[model samples]
Target chain A: MSAAAAAAGLVLLAAVGACAGVVVGAAYVAFMNALRVPARLAALTYTRHMTRIYEAAMAAGAFLAAVWLVFPYTLRLAPAAAGFVGAAMGVYVGMLASALAETIGVIPVVARRTGLGTWVTRLIWFVVLGKITGSLIYWLYPPLVP
Target chain B: MPTVYLKPRDSLIVAPGEDITLGMLAEFAAEDHELERTLRGQPFLPGLTEGHGAISVSSLDLVRAIRRQRQDLDLRIVGPAHTVVKPRVRPNPVMAGIWTAAVTLLLFFGSLMAIMFFHADVDMPLVHRGVYQLVTGEAAPRPLVLQIPYSIGVGVGVLLFFNSLSRRKPSSDPSPLDVQMHIYDQDAQDYLVSQSAAAHRADQARQK
Candidate 1:
């Protein structure tokens, strides 16, 4: 590909990514609204304005995160602090994944198709354990990652 | 006199042409078998004479009806004072299928795009390389061990967070989605009950 063409392609992908980020952010806010998170947290008068602020903040934060990602940086943290951060990030990502899965009704479809019936819970636990093992191995033994 | 304990529901959906008995309205328990049978069998609404839609029935009305029927029995009412009776309308299978498919597709694509965009924005590969170097004291183009585990962890974490497999929830606490749906259902029922009550008032005013 020519330099100009490659540049154009990159620009297009970035544009698409930006749009996707906006859509995802909006959807997240909507999901939170549907769950009445804000209402539960705040008084009725504050909730309406709070949601608007949240939307704007999320969009700005996404853009900022993207910009920051271009730089190569490393931070040193205490092992305990690192563990805490990792666990927190894991929780956020996990909830997002769960929401996506639940919305799509993935488990029910999979169970029905495989006819796993009563065994599905056990299978889920196995997957969870496998994930924990894999993550432990990755963090503890970094040489294997390369 | 036999004392009966009655717990009324907030809302109920009844099929067309089906009789709304006292059993259908509230759950009641009595020490005496004969009284229990009578209470359960007592008719509330003979059938859907008005055809279909939401109808609000008050517990005060129910208690009065029970008193008239079984003068010898003592009644104890608990919970909501009103119940909304809605007609059970079966949705078209094709329409239901289409709706489900649309939602599933939207959610699936949206989630995928979100993950992809976030990874791209963060320059994840570069971060992975940095992390790899930091951990192993060597630079690598891609960290397959970390990437592979992380990818799997996302899926597993989601499952664990939801604490659900199929229809059954592993934990007693309800998921956020479940709570949201419940709130939505309650809102709908409340709206229907209010509408029905308004209509009843209008009819009463017109009659007067």
Candidate 2:
């Protein structure tokens, strides 16, 4: 790519990152609310913490799926760039998706019993998994993609 | 005792110079020194000169202090109170930079893994060969013209999809993320208020 094209590509990627941030940040609110309601109801009661663990798993799965859908585009574009710019952009997308996923899964001790907590927790792990998967796709996908 | 008339409800009177702690705020009954940490630097007490101390201000100053931190308090003094609430301080640059870097790394890893797992599930090579044949009307090789636009379109598509998620045209519509963030902020405010109320109740119970 020419210098101008490369610069434009980077700028485009940056915009993508910003948009991703907004999407993930918005999703995080739902995740936290999920955690909060359960704790409020199960207040001071002794319940198994494993329920919260399960919630975390489910949320993680959702997040992973969401990130997976959005991030593959960057890889498709990587071959267009002359230098590392394309791969860098791919990384940027990956990171953006991952970071958003990370913020969703934390289940507070009080909120552990609620379905929301599990939902949020799963959402968080999903992002983490999504990031890992995205990275692997970028590196391991055949040259046809790059 | 110089009395100051509280606004909205003129029935209320505050006499500054009386020892006032956060516990005296009618709504916030914090334990000793707790208010100092929680509402620190926000002038909750007028004439609070010393450290680890009670706020001893006249009723007018008391009203002034309340107004300083909380303009929505509906409690105002009649006289000129020179209290100017300070703006929130800027975050430390170094700390901000570190946080930004950390977040960036985390995002990178997240996407990396995301692609990996997704690719594992699908047949990307077959998909590529299919697209190549469809675009070129040839065996398995696609030209740069077709490939370039297709790649660029992917980015554009992603943007268009997310922009529409906000339910309005891009650049004009406020992002749904902003709305979600606002909800979280309101939740935090509500949480703080509830905690304070809970603390007050606990204190009252102890006294009873």
TM-scores, one per candidate: 0.53, 0.36
Q: How close is candidate 2 to the true structure, as a TM-score?
A: 0.36
Name the best candidate (by DockQ): 1
Give the C-alpha miss distance for residue A140 in model 1, angstroms. 25
Q: Compute the lDDT of residue A85 as modeled in candidate 2.
A: 35
Task: Estimate candidate 2's RMSD in Å.
Answer: 20.6
Model 2 C-alpha lDDT per residue in residues A33-97, reported as the tens digit of each score: 44332232222133446557645754774565466556532234333331233333333333333
TM-score of chain B of each: 0.73, 0.45
- Please state the error at residue B168 of candidate 1 in Å: 7.0
Expressed as tens digits, the lDDT of each residue in B1-208 for candidate 1 is: 8788888889888877789998889988889877777888899886664447678898877899898877887888888878988777666678556655554444445544555455556665566556555445556576555455555555555554545544654354554444444555577678877787788789989999
Backbone clashes, candidate 2: 43
Writing each residue's lDDT as its tens digit, candidate 2 over B91-192 gives: 467855564454445544644444545544574434444434433334444334333333333333223212322344434543323334445544654554
Candidate 2 chain A, run of 10 with poorest lDDT: A109-118
All models: lDDT?
A: 0.61, 0.40
The residue-level lDDT of candidate 2 at B48 comes to 30
- Among residues 3 or more apart in sequence or in different chains, the pairs in candidate 1 whose N, CA or C atoms overlap within 3 Å are none
DockQ of candidate 1 is: 0.08
